[model samples]
Target: MSLAETGISDAPLILGSHTLRSRLIVGTGKYDTLELMQQSLEASGSECVTVAVRRERLYDPTGRNLLDYIDFHRYTLLPNTAGCYNAKDAVRTAKLGREILLGLENPGADWVKLEVLADTKTLLPDPVETVLACEQLVELGFQVLCYTTDDPVIAKRLKQVGATAVMPAGSPIGSGQGILNPNNIRICLEYLKGEDPDYPVIVDAGVGTASDVAFAMELGVDGVLLNTAIAHARDPVRMAHAMRHATEAGRLAFQSGRIPRRLYASASSPEDGVIGRTRQDRTSQ
Candidate 1:
């Protein structure tokens, strides 16, 4: 189905200075081939794509670079500090990305996807370090999109530190466990909207399928950022298409407003309908 048919036309979605046509944000990793990656991204209808920065590989001619395949004019490149361990590392990497990837044209590098992992096992954000980095980055004139946990307190702190959006993980990176704690995500959403109604809340990692994307949108999330789920799928291109559709469906469902759950049966059929009547009558059968 088309995005319009799915009812995504009304969701308030924005990224940096550009307004996105689709609420779903896709990643540019894990594709088997660059051609497939392009197809998947196009099918996903994502206006923004995330790309990781590594210092050692910056000059590698044969290495895969997002700029090599993606048309920069068409998509906004959201460079990320993926493997950084602390605020300093993240800031340094972000600065390099701004110079090499974003270039002099978009000198500000306006948006930075901040990820500072505390541990290698779970890849959870260290709130202390993350907040420190966020404050520094914001002061440096960058629009910080922080990757964080689903804790309401951490989210609040991130916002207070000048995060443009608070991205809480559904689970660990690449776990594909879907949303581990719906209540926490809901609380994060509540806290964000309450504190700054315009601040965006994006679901960042552990999204396994289209349903996970849909669930996040339905929860009033502004957007989603995922990678491994689509890239590692059996057919990555097809999975990308599914992700796009799922996000649109979820956004539409939210805008329309879901029905309230009830303990007792409440049928849509008319309560005054005749008990039992057939056009053929009882004797006919």
Candidate 2:
């Protein structure tokens, strides 16, 4: 049976103008080999794969590009301004990626992952430049997905400036911390999804394991986007499978509606419903 046949997924993830089958978005870098990356991506169950447009060594010494291994028809490429520290450079790289994808006749030409970094050390998005780039990209008729910090105000500002999707970081990029501040993420969801409940708010970065993906999903995010969690794992394929299952489980759990937390313990089986001596025992109590 296929994974979809398991009846786990609820609805398709409508990201920007694209309708993605899986809620997990995987990155197309950091793998040891192109073949490994391909295998891991296949295992991830993600319909969209993000690639860094800047400083990503697209072409190797053998003149073989990373795009050669990817199946353009199967995966929609979300080009990202990974290394751009300013809005102008990010916009230029985004345009370059669109041109390149358009030349390839791929449907991903209309969309871009806008990431204007604050600095080299933190790899956090420069909130101001990111917003500027997002506005510019939207003006250019591009579906801009802004990668920002876990700040709810910043996320709100991005949505206000016409960002198609606002991807708030779970924690520092590639930190393996895994949703260090879920309360902040919760507020991000509350603020972003206030009026538009279907608005896609993906938790990007700082996902170390499958549980992290599940936790983010349980927090009511539309999706979880990660790179190092799967790519840098001991076994990328295995990790991919784990993340896929986690995504499904988390979404299902959220839909199921968990019981509220309590300080005191509650009885599993009620006293009134107990078998033989249950009524008498309850009366005595």
Please list the residue runs of candidate 2 whose C-alpha ends up more than 4 Å from where it truly belongs after superposition.
1-3, 6-9, 55-61, 270-285
Question: Per-residue CA lDDT of candidate 1, range 83-195, in tens?
Answer: 89999999998888777655635423687999999999989988898999999999998889999999999999999888988999999999999999989999998988985
Q: State the displacement of the C-alpha of residue 249, model 2, in Å, after optimal TM-score superposition.
A: 0.8
Judge candidate 1 at residue 128 and give its lDDT.
90
Instruction: Report model 1's TM-score to 2 decimal places.
Output: 0.90
The candidate that achieves the highest lDDT relative to the unseen native structure: 2
**Deviation of model 1 at 8, angstroms:** 7.2
Clashes of each: 0, 0
